[model samples]
Target: MPVNTDPKLIAGNSNIPLADAIAKRMSMHRGQAVKPIDTRVERFNDGEIFVEVFENVRGEDMFIIQSTSNPANDNLMELLIMTDALRRSSAQRITAVIPYFGYARQDRRTKARTPISAKLVANLIAEAGVERVLTMDLHAAQIQGFFDLPVDNLYASPIFALDILHHFQDMEDVMVVSPDVGGVARARELAQRIKAPLSIVDKRREKAGEVAEMTVIGNVTGKRCIIVDDICDTAGTLCKAAEVLMDAGATEVHSYITHGVLSGPAVDRITNSVMKSLVITDSIEPTAAVQQCKNIRIVPTAPMFAQAILNIAGGMSVSSLFDNETLEPIYESLYPNS
Candidate 1:
């Protein structure tokens, strides 16, 4: 289904590079009029966020492309203020296109007295007048249930599978590994696509930033292992998992992750770890430390993201793009003979 409404795309301070890429994709498909909206966001002297949408979006379908990544609180507030501004301007419908949903790790309270901050963020966005949300690879799938509005949860599996296929041919010995038992379902999906065996890392998390002991649950000895997960923050678990995988006789250890929230000591840990390399999507803009890391490589997600925005604008199925069997045909349509 082709789209009817012209998109008035807007971007916040969170991920400008990704926003620009999505806007450019829309422009190429729609025309010059579908350009990115001019907007300014800044902080006042009192440390308050100020947002101004310079264009007239009254009755226009507005999509704000922002990721709630690092500086989680600031970025989250910026998206909220931007949504409020568009609502006040009479935009037809507001869609929060968040690539990395921060605070999503707190979806459920493991303890009795802690707050479910993920649900709180959902409520805050709904109260901010956001009518719809489009995000990719949420920390937990149930976060969609928290929203009162339409939420589209996209995945990176298609891209990751395509990447794996392009790099490897005889995948007989390749293994898709889950860093923890909690991620086994995700690992199973990837393992099925590549027709590779699966492995699980059973580890006990004694605290937030510490991993007590990790044990490999499958036969990874002398085989290449690809550890998969949603987010790699601080690199504690990833680093430790790599160490154990190597100690268990795995020839090489690599990781494929959606969001790289490489906070304090993450880069340092990755650089000194036994992992061969880490491949992360460009959901969160690459930082200077990430760019300088010798063991880290980034796979561009702009093309897929651009196609997704175009699909949503056209009222088409965005989830189909994430299908294991549907990605390559679409990729060939976008960039043939590549």
Candidate 2:
């Protein structure tokens, strides 16, 4: 079937700048048929949320852009209520475009009685009247299986890979490092794109909040190591990995993560760590903590996501966007000096 034209965009309060940029990329001016469903998201004295979509959406094809980031529950419920509102208003379809999917790390239960919160979130979205989902760089890939509806799990590696090649083009010795065994596949995929070697950090979890980096699995002694991962929450794993790599004789330690959900003292940890730079995408809105950190840098993912939204609306293959040979050139143009 052909992709439908005249797709309607509906945005939540999570990241309006990103939503606006995506709308712009789709060749739509800021205020057109596509505009934010004007409403106020508030809470009562008892701490419950209230949302109301002001505009009419009857028989429209709606795409809701929201990031389940900080105050994840609120942003999540906002999406749910927005979907239900659209459904009740007779919107033909509702697509939830969540750039930074929160609760994704809890895709599986490691303990005896723990809950798989990611699956539960998926159920919540489905039950909330979402017809499909569009997200990027989930913490766990298997979470896609949790969604019964059509799920488009996009990648940020192409964006990161191009950035690295442009910034470190002259540097001959380069290696992509995975902070833990779990991230080896993602790191390896990026490494293959840049023709760089791959290294793994062997980490031992002493407790819930602490990590001890043991050894480097691959040769990274003389190379500039770039640690790659999906998210940097507390920066515990990244800081530990950078220290371990530096101690292992690596020349430099850099990091590129998709979602910079830098909570708590993550920015402080990165600022005080051995890493020379920590590059991340704007999948999650940058908080004041990120703005205050000198070591943190943001790579705009607006174009990639914008193109994805356009393709999806036009009934084109969204996956083919990453397969382009011009990816490096396009991304490098965005960050010339890197």
Candidate 3:
């Protein structure tokens, strides 16, 4: 039998809305409605995961859209099991599209006897028979080397730059800031795109999830500062960074984070902090508190994901999607109303 080349999308319970949005955007690309495979990822009473794929995916190009976000273990297991099911079912190729890769921060062992969980997770994915992996804005770029298979790491800078351009009319006074020194490259890329200056927050971390002290490295006086980073967990770092910027005489502070892992007190901090707005992507499903937050906004990544999926399926260059000229058309196609 000839191998089925049509792309088939399957999603776990992590972010169904994002999966559906991607399907819709892909449908627009194909000029026909492309729906996700009828798969059910349910749990047993004892907290075991059970995944059932109703559609025939045999010999098809299968893409599983699942983010290893909150409840990271369960979501990761779901993706692995789903990949196993597809491989066993004789799918031609299986790609795991994880928007938010969990345990990415543990890419290295900072101390003795600590495990590099990111590499371990990469090994698990490879062992599960996944042929390819597509993820976005990894906490550390080095994590890509851990994967044995082809891993397409997409960037959110294109999306974020577009949003920043539309939101802020005066680009001269806008400054792109890296919440920490490590993120300076990410922030610099966005700064170049918008023709803005870049600044780094000099910070020292005593331990995980805690900051010892922070100081501004550049003049933020009378400037509209936008902090760019990959993750925002407890909001401690971001909130403190905002405060430091404010203390440095910043006219206003804002943030464009890729993953909004707003855990305990994150929403509260952002709500009461000096930041003007917080923009994040729909990599993880937002909780009710996040949705109700006044200053937080979510931008859809479905269009970019849809374009990437199309390129992969068509054997096109994925990197071409990053060019401003290339991204403008994609942004227009998916978000015509905007």
On a 0 to 100 scale, what is the lDDT of residue 329 in model 2?
43
Q: Report the number of the highest-lDDT candidate.
A: 3
Stronger candidate by TM-score (2 vs 3) = 3
Instruction: Give the winner by TM-score.
Output: 3
Q: How well does candidate 3 match the true structure in TM-score terms? A: 0.97
**Per-model CA lDDT versus the true structure:** 0.86, 0.84, 0.92
- How far in Å is the alpha carbon of 300 misplaced in model 3? 0.6
Which regions of candidate 2 deviate over 4 angstroms? 1-3, 28-34, 326-338
lDDT by residue (1-338, candidate 2, tens digit) is 33356677878888888888787766542245455557666678987777777777776667899999998998998899888888988887789999999999888878899999999999999999998899999898899999999889889988887788778976579999998898999999998888888889988887776885478898888889999999888998889889889989999999999999899989989999999999998888898779778989998887777667666776777788576464554454576654
RMSD of 3: 1.7
lDDT of 3 by residue, 15-62 (tens): 999999999999988899999999888999999888889999878999
Per-residue lDDT of 47 in model 1: 81
lDDT comparing candidate 3 with the true structure: 0.92
Which structure is stronger by lDDT: 1 or 2? 1
Error of 2 at 33 (Å): 8.2
lDDT of 1 by residue, 1-338 (tens): 22345667899988898888777766766666455688899999998999998889888778888899888899999999999999999888888999999999999999999999999999999999998898888999999999988999888777788877776666777899999999998889888888899999999988988988898998899889999999999999999999899989898898999999999999999999999899998899989999999999887676677777777777888877877556676566533432
